[model samples]
Target: MTADENWWNGSVTYQIYPRSFQDDTGNGYGDLKGIIRRLDHVAGLGVDAIWVSPFFTSPMADMGYDVADHRGVDPSFGTMADFEALVTRAHALGLKVIIDQVLSHSSDTHPFFLESRSSRQNSKADWYVWADAKPEGSPPNNWQSIFGGPAWTWDVRRRQYYYHQFLKEQPDLNFHNPEVQDWALDTLRFWLDKGVDGFRLDAVNHYVHDAGLRDNPPDFRDKTEPDYKTYEMQYPVHSKNQPENLAFMERVRALTDSYPARTLIGEIGESHYPVERLQEYTAPGRLHQAYHTALMHKPYGAAFFCKQIEAMFRDAYAGCPNWAFSSHDVPRHVSRWSDHAVTQDDFAKMTAALLLSLRGSICLYQGEELGLGQSALSYDQLVDPEGKTFWPDNPGRDGCRTPMPWEAQAPNAGFSSAADTWLPVLPPEAARAVDTQGDAESVLTFYKQMIGLRQDQPALRAGDLVFLDMSEPVLGFVRGGEILCLFNLGLTEAVIDTANVGDTLLSRFADVQDEQITLGGNGFLIARRLSE
Candidate 1:
């Protein structure tokens, strides 16, 4: 790929939720040294880049998402020297390193927030989003958090309500404040200077809020949504996806422009504005790629995939969008879509192949290739505060945060030598251990081969998506006007009416033929366009 060309296209991004990836010191949590030790395993997966979740200094309230020190590593993860070694090792293994940047907020223990909350006259008083309580003391507005309940929290010292879109301990950063923006940008440069390749901007759109502090409008449409955020029935018009955030994104773009071949990807989430904001964030001088929750859920079927990819292509946003069937925030795809027509193993392999064949880039959450299902955690075993609050209604994301299984027989799945791990690894996942799945016919092996195909095939890499409309359960598209992709999301057999296109290049099951293509249940077809 050219220097200016986007490297993220068709690239496989491996997401390592550091806390659960591996534990080096047996401290009951995975750390930086553990990641460094496993760099070879990651590189062996044929992924183009590795995206490490936050390891920034924090109180562990939100598992390091609440940053106390932006430039330093948490003692639990490792020291700065260990981080440097990780970057060096990852790069040496031909893997790009992208760290998570939690620019949206910081822990209450953060110096800026501590000073900001002390009094209104402090040097950093405006560093966080703070507002006086209403006369009725109900709250600034009806902004419920994803974790549940009101997004605003009371502060006894300041006697004012402060904003936190997430956990109250994670106070929202005042991106509206010029100093705050400058400080965040400087922090970005600090890691860039450390030889980091890129950043996965956490809740990037949530950085800025409505200066007016107006209440979010009601939305009774999605009242059936299991969570409080959706049940509050409010459209977060002024609260998130603020018009002002785009200009700041341009500033971030300018800062990253100085670094050669570096990338910036934002995690765009807003109930009202999704794909449109994705386009705005990545249009030219903003983010290199923007990911949404479009293909991140739902069954691995034809209609859902077709509608999503086709919509992106029709909107012309497919060029810079990133797709993942599963991530840390959601249940594993194997478990989520296991209800569809196939076994868990088939669901996992099919999703992996489909993700690699998509027009845009892809992110592979850790252990996804092994067909790891969501870990079953009882209410008592749930360590995630988010999960605890929602209880049985909204189980939160604890299921996907379980430790990775490396061994089939070792206790704790060999994730840690420690007597216990942060989260238990289930027996089924243990059976799909890396050691057992390293062989040629294993699911892991298939992922390796498919990822290699994506990297090596130009048509799959920088391809323009061409929609091939078909009946339900059959999703079809052309990559680079050369590679034809078809997916059967339903149970029964499906046909690829290749009357216009010719012969199958690849098939999930069955052999290639000269003319039409027939696929069995949960089958897929890939073909090279005939010379025209």
Candidate 2:
């Protein structure tokens, strides 16, 4: 494939949560100007692209995920000129820019939603997923928000209930309307015309609903749960992951194809059948890549890894998978899987190696290379609506969204000049700050070497994956029949046959003895095969 067609394949894309990455405005929040100043740091990591989270005009209800304007930047994140500068600087550093597109829903404050909800026969009455209440007037159906409670919220003006998959403030758009689809496509086209390399399409599966307003069936797997109180109590067959979504995917691909070399990555938000959904989205002529949380959970093992990988790659044309161990929404992998490792750093390094070695593209979250753990916050310090609403049971996403630490000795760890930040910069993250760990065999250094190594070896990059016969702790695989990759996720040292293992290209906490390879806790090895 030509560079234009295959440049995104197996590439490393760094994810930047713009709000917490760096603060240049001294307003206690990072903005596009900060990112412009930090472009060199991202390019230095040997990554191909940067996936910036939303910085659009918003009410901050669900952070920038609740976008009030699709085509404008929020003043807090700086003006359109700042965003243009950011894209220019990133491109100048050889880094492609991928901005987030929250097309599934819009902030209730958005003009579109405002006009739609004003009256029954407005110009855009069906612009949003608004429906009449049931005869009893409780809700339209038993559909529940992913966060919690009923997905439908009553609007007094329209005298109809609007569907919200997240916060009540984020109302779902009615993609069933062709005009809505055209509007969404225009949003994508605007950014593309402005030279954005790609988009991280948020909640891609939630674009359309069943339209029949059918109640979702109960999730009988866990019997004790009450219906409509939680998202997990029922299977979301009607609410999301609908069959019509595939048609929209093709439309998105059609638009993306119009702009050569621009890629579309869909975030499959459904709980059930995510892998299958990912496969469908990534099939020929669909998204360039699609990813779900198949590996981001708390579980740690070869068994889990094998299951997710096998299922994801079962179809030859399932398309490319974009793997990530941690993100702004999930707990830091190092912290989530810390108990299984002999040391925190070891686990972090292992995950870095594992993620880059997978047979698809990679998304490295900001601060992942620094071995940052999830920050623990007091209830009073919580800013996330989900964290505040769910409290002890589910702490929500605030911990992972904390500011990135740059200098250990600088005020606020050089994250901001303000007296305090939107989220406090904790000691653990500060200790592993970029300035503190200066090339002394650290996780940051390891990530650089590993990424470089992947670039040096073609098999490690665009090669097909073939899993080996291994059990439990030892997850072994070969790339393009030349690279032998082995990872021991458990504390117990496990041995794997090393007959075809040639030169030890890169290894950590591993021992090689003739025909046997012993991997220590969170150990890994990447090697090339002997000349045939």
Candidate 3:
């Protein structure tokens, strides 16, 4: 098959949260040059590509997720030349680069938004979603922001309320306007022309809201749940996730297809019928792949994995999934699932195996290979707006967004020369730094072996996934009818007969007898089928 056809079908991508990944200037923030210096380490991991979070020109209100200029590199990240060199270095190391594209909204300071809000009849007027308030000066609708409170912010310049799905500083663009659609496409072309392999489209569902200015109905599901987010109190069918996204995605796909081997992946933040939305967005002519937060949530069990995996493959029309255990926006899986493990390293190794063995593509967050857990930060040290807004009860994602620890005893864990980081580099994280985990039994070593095994065994990559019948705490599956994978995900030992399975190809904490296979807690086995 040609490389362009489906290079990401079962590929593995390493995600780099640029600000906390590596700092080269001793400025307490990571930049493009720091990432360039670390390219060799990423290439050594046997990953297919790297997906970087935003580094575009931004005010950092949302830490680069809010873009002020779509086409320019932020000075905090480095000059435009630094980005060009980064792409050059990544390609030389055999690593494809995928950058974050925040297309749904732009910073309020953006010139386009400034012009759009400037009197109703300016040349750039109608560039953003603008609506007049009610007679009593109330918001146009009951739609809420994901960050907090009302989704509408009043702007006196045009005597209208502008829409922001996230922070008020970020104004949603009017995709219903063809001109805005063209501008978004042009922003994407700006990067494709710079040699990027793909883009991780941010907030793909929030692109076009209902043009009718409808009020969202109350959501009955989450009102009873503890610590339920205020925004999710109402069903957002009309507020966002409009059917219009499907056609807009096709336009994005068409532009991406113009370049060789380019890809487009979308992030669906929908809570209602999420998997279906993921599939709808990634249909043949749209996004190449799309991911939802199903796996990233707190649910952990064989049944949960079985059901979620089955949902993705059951519908042939829904495009394939790219699975992740942790990311910049969520808590680290090790810390999140600590109840299931006897040791953090064992759980980390087991989760890594499970994620890699899945049917679709994989994305590994930085420091995952080293078994890094989420860092706990004091309220005073919080950097995430989400975390600060929701203190105590929900400490936000700052815990998971800590700096990458590269060395154990070196200054700031060899991540930066500065004494402090934008987010503190906690000691627990520094203890498991890459330098300290090179032992034969380290999680890092196991990750390399697992990634190599997946690359070596085609059945693990593109093979069809047929789940075997197993009860709770024990999961088994066959790939391409040749490779059988078994896992014991409990806190105690389990023994099962595996006489039908052939020689073991890989295992951890597993012992095989004549017919019975003994699996210790968090144990796993990958064997070739005897009949194959």
Candidate 4:
């Protein structure tokens, strides 16, 4: 099992939202010790790596995303020793550890920001994105935060506005300053020296914004999305996905390349031209891989999926993609795509198989393996600021970020020893706890099986994809030139003639008889093509 220069090739990286993974201290909050306690569970899934979300020292403005100190672990999550232990234990289990690095922004409480805001003549005054307000005291530009407000926040001391692409507490860093870039690189070095295998760079596309401070063009697209945020009303051309980000990525890549087999996976959150940015950012000498929010947000269907995948491969031929159907920020895929499947469990298994069959690396969100659907939380139970702002109409991400259910009958579903959790665990999620499905022919087992198949099959792991002509509802593609992967995204049965398609390798809720394949509702199949 030797790895090449690109060890992440054809691998599965399980994403663990540290706050909800496990709470080992009975503090009602997940910590490093909890993740260490659950390493075996993750290893059992046969994933190649684990991507732990930020556990950095922070003010918790946006959970752990708003870091107050880049190099220190948050006291709530654990100390530096605990993080070291986690890395050591993960390495012992043959799992590479990829920690989330939120380089785009930091909490306003961060030391640099504090100093920068104190006075205009301070040494670090320009460390963060600061601009003067227009004559009318309006924001410098028409940029909007992803969290539904103006991107600029007024600061009394400096009498200037600081930009934040999220909550005002999270001030965006000024990549235009060479000193800031150097400092950011040094921060990456600190983690790399700590024996981390890689980093999932948060909001990599947002690293650089238009230096000229131009207004973003309006987004006139029809608003059909149920949970549409006001931020989506603008094109965000000048706010993010700037060309300067590519050079900065190259700098990031140069640093990671110095470490043996270390990788960098950038998260590109651009609503429009995300794939284009992903392709540019992940090209050779840039980040090793790039993941966009397309899969997590798009409507479920063969056509939509096929179009996304094909566009990614076509545009980013030289780059690698890290595909994921769910994450801490988005609703769980099983629930998000519920209308497209027959049953939750059935859809989970089918999507698992389909995700594993795709080319490039994959990221399995923490609870997806247990077929966990979104936990419906009330407005009062919501902790995500985005959810709170759009409550009733748009429930926030707390539903997806709820604690991981470990025990079906235990207190707080065994997520915490405390009577209450940060977010309530709904009964539906508790019922599908890991203990109940550990041995059964459940979604967890199916994920393990599919992942094992991916690990054993070279074609499925590192294959070049070639789409086959198939009608609506059925997606057919050849991987590595020999493996035929087909999926039925419709609710009804779909049949495809397999007169020339080869040996059946794996099937989920589907059957093949007399050279014809019949995929039941939400079914899928993977086969090896017959050699000429």
Quote each prediction's TM-score.
Answer: 0.96, 0.97, 0.98, 0.97
* Residue 283 lDDT, candidate 4, scale 0-100: 85
Candidate 1 global TM-score? 0.96
Where model 3 places Cα greater than 4 Å from the true spot, the runs are 1-4, 222-227
Higher-TM-score candidate among 1 and 4? 4
Kindly list the per-residue Cα lDDT of model 3 for residues 197-241, writing each as its tens digit: 999999988999999989999875744455446687888989778
| TM-score, structure 2 vs. true | 0.97
**Per-residue C-alpha lDDT of model 2 across residues 354-459, encoded as one tens digit per residue:** 9989898899999998999999989999999998888887788999999999999998899999998999998988999998777768888888889988877889
lDDT of 4 by residue, 1-532 (tens): 2266678977899999999999999988999999999999999999999999999999897999999999999999989999999999999999999999999999999999999999999899889999998999988988998898788989999999999999999999999999989999999999999999999999898988899999989895666664467688899888887788888888999999999998899898876677788888888889888876788974877788888999898843867899999999999999998988799888998899889988888999999999999998878787889888878767878999999999999998999998888888889999999999967579999998899989998888898988888998998898988888898888899889866677778888778787889999889988878875
Kindly report which residue pairs in candidate 3 clash with one another: none
Alpha carbon deviation, residue 522, candidate 4 (Å): 1.7
- Tens-digit lDDT track of model 1 for 466-518: 77778877777788888888777767777665655566555676444556677
- Model 4 alpha-carbon drift over 4 Å, by segment: 220-228
Query: In candidate 2, which residue pairs clash?
Result: none
lDDT of 1 at 66: 87
